[model samples]
Target: MEQAKDLLAKGVLKPGDYAYHEGLSDWTPLLEVIVANSEPEASPTPSVGPSLSTAPTPKAKSNATLVVGIVVGLMVLGGLAAAGGWYFFLRDEPMELVKTTPPLKVNVPPNKEVEKILAREIGIWKITGHRLPVIDPETGGPGKAEDIRDTIETRWKEKGKSTVSTFSPVINGKKVSFVGYKEYDAKDGVFIWRVKGEGLPETVSKERYDPVTKTFHGEVNYQNNTRELSTFRRINKDRVHFKSKLFDADNKLLGTSEMLFTRLEKKEPDQPPMTAGSLTAKEAAEVMAWVIGKWETKGKGMPVGGEPQAIEITMEARWKEEGKSVEFKYTMEEGGKTVSYFGHQQYDEARGIFINRSKWGDNPETTSHERYDPATRTSRAQSMPVSPAVGSKTTTVTKRIGQDKTQQTLEVYQDGQLVYSHEIVSTRIGRYVEPARPEPAPHAPQNGLVAYYPFNGNARDEAGHGHDGTVIGARLTADRHDRADSAYQFKLGDHIRIKGLMGKPKNVTLAAWVKLNGQQGRSGADIISIGTSVNIRVDSKSGTGGSSRTGRGSWLGTNAKVNYTDTGWHQIVFTFNDNTDRQVVYVDGTSMAASRNQIPIFYEGRETDTVVGINGRERNAGFETQGVIDDIRVYDRTLSAAEVKALFHSE
Candidate 1:
């Protein structure tokens, strides 16, 4: 008490410092009690010593009683408040407190939480893996990826404000589909993914993040019947997983969607990926980016599926890494099926030309070395679809007719002969149509293993049959499970041969996982080629993939439309039941169109003469499997459909 009095006399201790009481659980400043108990001191004179009060101050009994009563009243009130707090804890309603306006600040960061989110989202993130559902056209809700490669890039608009732009890649170009913002209310705790531009009012989604699980979930709240719940979970530093659930205005659950993304590494826009090149990888990539959007034919059309009527041709372009090139997919209706041509383009500065390689149907891949004239703004090339056969020259002039219209004039020459050529106009389309979820893959096959070629470490066979395959030009690459695991990657002239492994077999079931770097090729891309006699192979002509096991069928399964040649690791199984004279082909565990040939497997070469990548004797015209193959197995007996399905699920 003496030390406290001395400090108070020196103005070092304030009245509020005495905030605790002997029996209290909570701290409250003793402002009133301390001030009343403190005696006022006289103004300081020249002397430093404090003058003591000679007379003692007397207190009345009534005053003391009053003070004691006040203290008792406060104690009772505090206890009652504490008990009430505990009682209302289970109620959902939050306790209200006296609110006050915050003082205006000059320069302070708003919502450090938002800053953390933006930090993780600074660069472009592309949708590489996806599991979104097909939207019901009538419901008008979210759907699966439209463009094969969907992307989003974020940027800071200002301090505490940000923008997000969504992108989609077409055959040879890219376009922005949607742009929005990350906004929050200054007075409330609500954070939003706000979209307000063009002709509509703002659309806002209340977003929140959980640090513990690294999960982000939000709902787009508006007056309409749209109740979209979206979530994003960080899989790692470079990857993020997203999901969406739709709900009606009444909060009833509707449907859901999902996608996975990998953040694109940032690079210098002007630097090329390769050091020794006329056009740097970056420059070629930039040029390719300009040509990546979708282009559709105008009012005019062409014959489709042997029909005289015109059909629309759609071309989409997107960025592909390998050679730092751009890839294109040209799709059209032909022969009652969707036919697609895939191609890649790169620039050669030394040659002052751009080279385009396209493969489709039975047509040999054409490599066009063309030059772009900036003055004429035209593209011209001289090449042939077939080498050393009939040379052709192509010249194209494109002019932007309108904001969404482009007119192109094309002229072609075959050898010295002039071909029918004319001017055609195409319209620029934005975004893409949502796609349905892809069919699920097959489970792995267990038991009854005959010839198992995991292709791990070496081409040594694991089947204990000693029918090992000899790897030729194929290289070992990362398998589906892990980067350390190995798979045979075949490109161009690469192949594998297993002598006497598959020849003159009464019944044989072959299954393997294949990832096609180039699903499209001259003639067809063969997974396995039997060089012996009958000229049989599992091949895809254009995009209509079919195996000889299912007699005269399209790539479509027994049901509706499907293209089995999509670029991915698909488990393909060829089941030949000699007794039943029946054959079935499965893609990723789902039954696809197959051809039937009861004739048993036979070959003219030595027994077990089997080949992969390319078929001998022009079965597929040397169209090699430019991709990766893994976990290949050749069983002497056919697997039941149920067994096949179980195998797919097991993997």
Candidate 2:
């Protein structure tokens, strides 16, 4: 484009050479095209010498230019004609046109049978009952049974989304109010009962309704070791029969309550009435989801006339595989010792069978498989332990009483005679929390390092187990290596308080390096104390007085004479063995005297578990360490004497 413009500007158009404008298809003689486009007042061309090329007369140039223009315009019009013809008329075939159809609609409604059950239960009921078998604290015999009245009000709301039931029971001049929601859980493929109220632990009940019998039943589990077998029967549209039997974890029947409820009122539901329907084959076949929660046996009551005191076991069930199966865990803490186990709980829907397969510590694996008879609402399981192979097969049968509760019995047979029996009436109590994912690497792989406060300036849990200590009145000091502020120093009221982590029954080892000032009376000062804000106060009183050891009403230990006040850094360890039933004291990794505790030295699972450097004293009076302490580590499992020594020397 620049070259063409330059040629035109310089009067360089050749007479016989062709010229063309943008958009023109045909080219015209240069002299003719220039003459037609030249301005009227532009300078006339100067004549060239004989060697220059020239054109014909101006008139002849005009005619040739006109001819070229006509040809170009014709070509342009022809191209436009073809493009427009193809776009408007040539792309389609001569076929018939059709219109779009609307999408199909299918009916997906709620279960008809379930809706019918809910409708029948939508009324207020008033009941009266009695609590039985209360123990007499003074006479050591049966006490007067307590009588009570309860009001159960149920209503359906939010257009059939759920049924709400409120339970208000008047007992011993106290009114207990609880609200429960009964709804179908889509994720679990079953109906669930959840209730919450003041002073009541969270409870959940799994319900089943039998249409033929017009009855509903459920097992209700309280999070705090209590469960009950409850049944509901609609005698007529005007009344319902309700019965519940309460039991503790040790399978001791606490009492029974039977209530004949009269319908007080009913509210009509709005709109196209909800219908009832049955569950799918898959939902009816599986029970694992209904059991997904924490379950505990109430540690109350016992064998009417025997020892073996009530043993409470807390079990947790968590689901996996889209609720097809669960992983179960349990812990039992009794007699200063705790036992824990982990297992997989799975169900085979096709075979109407479920299994609880568990393994603990170095113990053998025990697998219990249960076959359910749906018609009788009962299941029987045979458990076999391999490894330390207890060859005896134990059979357990669970009878689901109503929609909400179950009763289970275990019989251990040895050589054809029943050697042992364990029974429990458990219920679903609470949902499981998602377990935390552990860090890829642990700080130290040393055996049983549950909590480690290195005190490298601040009390941080280097073990990454999250049990960090709070330095109450300690100041950072220099260590032997002259590492500034690596250890802690306490003077007068200076101390540290570590939250109690010894809730469960386990052998524990608390080891730390300490250096105390050789001051008078500082001899018996506490190095550490474990307790709640109130109970389980393990005042490490000096190894001196019997009163400190016995009747101080605290589990007291002391430098009684280990002489930590020598003004030199020494290793101190507290080795508590729930199994051995004693708390041993060690100085510089050497064992001192041992003491038998009134109760095993386990802590309440609560805050204020341990107070360091002070003996039950937060202020002025009690013994406080005037010393330096470092390298505090706590373990959940017991360490042998050799292991404790190794831990100290490892520093």
Best by TM-score: 1
Question: 61-178 in candidate 2: lDDT tens per residue?
Answer: 2322222211111110011110110011011112111111111121222576557656666766665443333232234354334443445556663325567554433322344334
lDDT of 1 by residue, 408-438 (tens): 6555554334553555677768643323322
Assess every candidate by TM-score.
Answer: 0.30, 0.29
lDDT of 2 at 244: 48
lDDT of 1 at 514: 79
- For candidate 2, what is the lDDT? 0.49
Residue 158 C-alpha lDDT in model 2: 30
CA lDDT scores, all candidates in order = 0.48, 0.49
TM-score of 2: 0.29
